[model samples]
Target: MKNCTLDLLGIKDSRLQFDPKYKNKVTTDDFYNHRKARFIHLLQSYPCFCPVCGKKMKRNGFKTVEMVGLPSGGLTNIFSIRKQKYLCPSSAACPKTITKLAEVQDVKANARISQAVKYQAVSKLGQNISQKYIATDFCISSMTVMRFAQGVSTYLKPNQHYLPQNIAFDDFKSGNFSQSGMSIIVMDIATHRTLDIVRSRQNTYLRSYFLQYDRQARWAVQTVTVDLYSPYRAFIHDVFPNALIIADRFHVITQAYRALNQVRIQAMKQAGHGSHNSRALKHYWKLLTKDSAHLDFKHYHKSRNFRNLQLCEQDIVERLLAMSADLRLAYNYYQTLLQAVHQGNPALLEELTQSAAGLPDPVKKTNRTLRKHRQEIKNSFETTFSNGPIEGTNNKIKTIKKTAYGFRNFENFRLRILVELKNSYVSLNFHSA
Candidate 1:
């Protein structure tokens, strides 16, 4: 016979994958409820001495302790432990005077679920799973899931004392109303880890909040990437004098394209709102936003509408630009600026900004704004830094919030983000807790 063979019957229990620790002492008994399989584990203990007294004691009786458990046999689970109880013949023999129960395994006080169940639930929480689902899966209450999430967050939480040399800053909507909070997150650009979060993006509050960090940590920062927010730019200047501010290319293009869209709208109106040119302009709006390099100049229109001109994306853009000289100038400037940033031509940017007198008011305004932070705009060419990572992090935060139905407290929301971020990349372990 082989030394080891596959236990096909043992392979039948899926709960084993959930890490059942007390295998030697716990026995599994399962039944069906409403045609659904349910698991019950009977927990008992061997005779042992009290840790405090270190004196062997006879097992006098058993007390039933029920705990939430992971799913087993493709169904729900329940654990009923016959927890051991020992009687000290002489009260003086027990060193700890108050306790009557002898410990067998570690479990949280006044908690129905075992630590194992809590752990597995917390691990799922980090994946942005709904608490209701976790509660049902682990046979626990939603509140217990919340408590576990909070603990797991605290465990994997980063050190707040340090901010890395390269950093990115961006704000996300915490609540919808004007009276609601505006939350901004600071991230370490090198490690791409979130540093900390603040409840408000207001200048006064942000300045005061960042000022509290260690001076050396502030000085350690070498570069900061920011969106077009002037206050954020100003805040970085004052707080991190040694760091160069790099305006993210994505934000610059985003703002420029926003202005370009306005120009396009004006072109449509000039073409007559209901006219063929204007309708084509609206239908081919996506064509304008696309990169010219990707445009198929020979491609023909397939749809049969008002005009079957069979114009490719490039041809459509050219026709759209021909609608108005002002629109042409704005589109040219938008494309040129994108190229300048991309090709690292600071001189081109300077020329375009300085000669903005001929552009539409919107384009001129955008150029002026870019020129105001001229040095930061130029700095984008020096390094690759973007709030791109911030988008991914924000998506995770949004997922966590949505899954939880929504967090009423900002601190809990913040904690959930912190832990959930870590949870995605790191496996949950007892040592981590």
Candidate 2:
């Protein structure tokens, strides 16, 4: 029974002695609205000699302390321990007296919480829940829960000595965390682990931040995948001299996707409001934006937009395209770009971008963007890397923010994200320190 009680409480200190009549007693905790298990024990280990004078010490008295322990069998465990106190041997020549209390390794000095409980609390912080929820679980205040998390975060700091060979960069809405309201998220492409989250994505801030790493670390990065954010390209080139900046394929495709949609909207407007053509354009927007190759030509159905005309997806799209000459031109460009990207054909994309004349203004702008980052876009097609992992990490950050309703303190927010996402940094026994 004694061994079981020690195991349940995670008490490894051999000096601590359990009471003869000690038993796991469960009682109702009205304040916390839960059941608690109370155990009584005594810590009577005495110091053999005083550190100050190297003389024998004498026992003074026992100091009673109440410490919260890990929950067992759905009940909160509390330890009432009597710690032995000692006084150093007094001498006329030494003229100094020291008093000390025997301490347990599992619990910190003057703290009412055991290290085991703190470890559990820190582990719970990694989950997608608010600190208040963790507080309720441990029957402690929310402030205490935050302190436990902060303590673990001290050891979870990112290792700035090394950087990954392939990395991806992106930003998310920081929501009052930074002055710019946006923060950069760096991720390792190989491991798909979030490397770190910088407080700002501004050019100067990014340059200074990456410069903290040694020249070798910066030069080791080979490829950096990013969206169409103009500042990011400049920042990458300046900091990582050898890294090839790969434009995100999704963003590149989105540029053409958006332009094509704009052309369709214009076509709808030219068709006039409340007209059959305009209504058809509005209704079949998905078909217009969908990849032309995926349209089902075999599946035939009656269409309500064309007097119940017998038509398939291909037939409907072809008929819609015939409504406006500008729509046909934009659709052809978008479909060509989409195919080029999907097929990983950079030559076709280059050809289309080079000769995009007579295209609408929106498409022409997209063509210019493609021309500007032509090499990066080609690198994107050649490499298997993308910003997909960082995008997923951003989604997790959003979930963390939403679960907490929002974070007023950016450090706490960042720590929570790192604790949750960067598992390599957090350890199971971090709180033992």
Query: Against the true structure, whose lDDT is highest?
Result: 2
Ten residues in a row with the worst lDDT in model 2?
Answer: 422-431
Stretches of candidate 1 exceeding 4 Å from the true structure: 1-45, 48-55, 91-99, 156-158, 176-180, 300-307, 422-433
lDDT of 2 by residue, 84-150 (tens): 7889756863577788888888777788888887878878887887998888788788888888788
Question: lDDT (CA) for every model shown?
Answer: 0.71, 0.82
**lDDT (0-100) at residue 172 of candidate 1?**
85
Question: Best by TM-score, which number?
Answer: 2
Lowest lDDT sum, 10 consecutive residues, model 1, at: 1-10
For residues 1-433, what per-residue lDDT tens digits would candidate 1 score against the true structure?
Answer: 1112112212222222222344643344543334343444444455567566767766677686665555666665555556656654556756454335533244566666667776777777667677787777766677877787677554444444677889888888888421446788788777776777677888877888888877888888899998888877677778888998888888888878988899889888888868877887788888787767778877677533335656667777887787789988988888888788788899988987887878898998898888887888899888878889988888877777778888777766776676567622222342353
For candidate 1, what is the lDDT? 0.71
